[model samples]
Target: MNKKQILTGFLAVTIFAACQQGTANQDKAKDGKSISAGAKVPAAPDAAILTFEKESYDFGKIKQGEKVHYDFKFRNTGKTPLIISNATATCGCTIPEIPKAPVKPGDEGIIKVVFNSTGKMGIQDKVITVTSNANPEINEVHLKGEVTEP
Candidate 1:
């Protein structure tokens, strides 16, 4: 073959090889794999962490001498089991009920709050303290609303 022809053949072969290499790299990237690029991945959070979906409750408007109840649902988003030690209301007029057992990861639980507005008038605010194994350890949930006079 002429020198010009040989050089043209070499260039075509090199281009083909480069194209094949690029296709292989794309396939590796498409395999749904990930790498940290020499960095360590963060450890999963503890399983026993109690995380509430909401931080507060609004009771809206209620008449005096009435009663209301609300349930706050939560999920165990950590990697360990979650345990709620206790739940306390801000005042005697408000009652809170917390889960009694540990909640496994991806599981759900509830916290129930009952408010008695017998003697309360106008707006009322209450809080429920939740003690758990969550990162912050202690969480305070709040309840607020207006109690209109009957």
Candidate 2:
């Protein structure tokens, strides 16, 4: 073939190769394969529901240097299991514990919070954020109490 024809043929082959590569990449994505670049993969079946009996708790009042406990009950209102991934307190003095097992639909669970008033005084407001598979994915629970001087 002439030089022009040769160049045109090479161009066609290059374009074809690029198109094939793109199709392959799309196929990989469809097959749940990660590309070379590190990107966040979406979780499978991305919807859930969680219902809480009470979002906030009032401890009323407690003496300084004392520890108090509270339980925040919730229900799995969604079709799938409710998995609480983690729970975090607003301050070090406040600790929270959550169930690791999945709560089935229509089942009940509890998030227990403990507030330590050691060295802490006056009115206090704390928060615990619970992360889960529930739709909206995060739940906030509040605690408030007045700490009397020991």
- Computed on alpha carbons, the lDDT of every model, listed in order, comes to 0.82, 0.86
The sequence of per-residue lDDT tens digits that candidate 1 reaches over residues 1-150 is 999999999999999998887655532223356543443333345536667788888989999988989898898888888889889987899999888888888999999999999999988889899887776677788889999988
Looking at model 2, report the run of 10 residues with the lowest lDDT sum: 35-44
Q: For candidate 2, lDDT tens digit of each residue in 15-125?
A: 999988766664335577756434434555635577889998888888999998999999987888889999999899999999989999889999999999999889898
Q: What's the true lDDT of residue 91 in model 1?
A: 89
On a 0 to 100 scale, what is the lDDT of residue 81 in model 1? 84
C-alpha RMSD (angstroms) for model 2: 8.4
Among residues 3 or more apart in sequence or in different chains, the pairs in candidate 1 whose N, CA or C atoms overlap within 3 Å are 46-79, 46-80, 47-79, 47-80, 47-81, 48-80, 48-81, 48-82
Q: Candidate 1, TM-score vs. the true structure?
A: 0.67
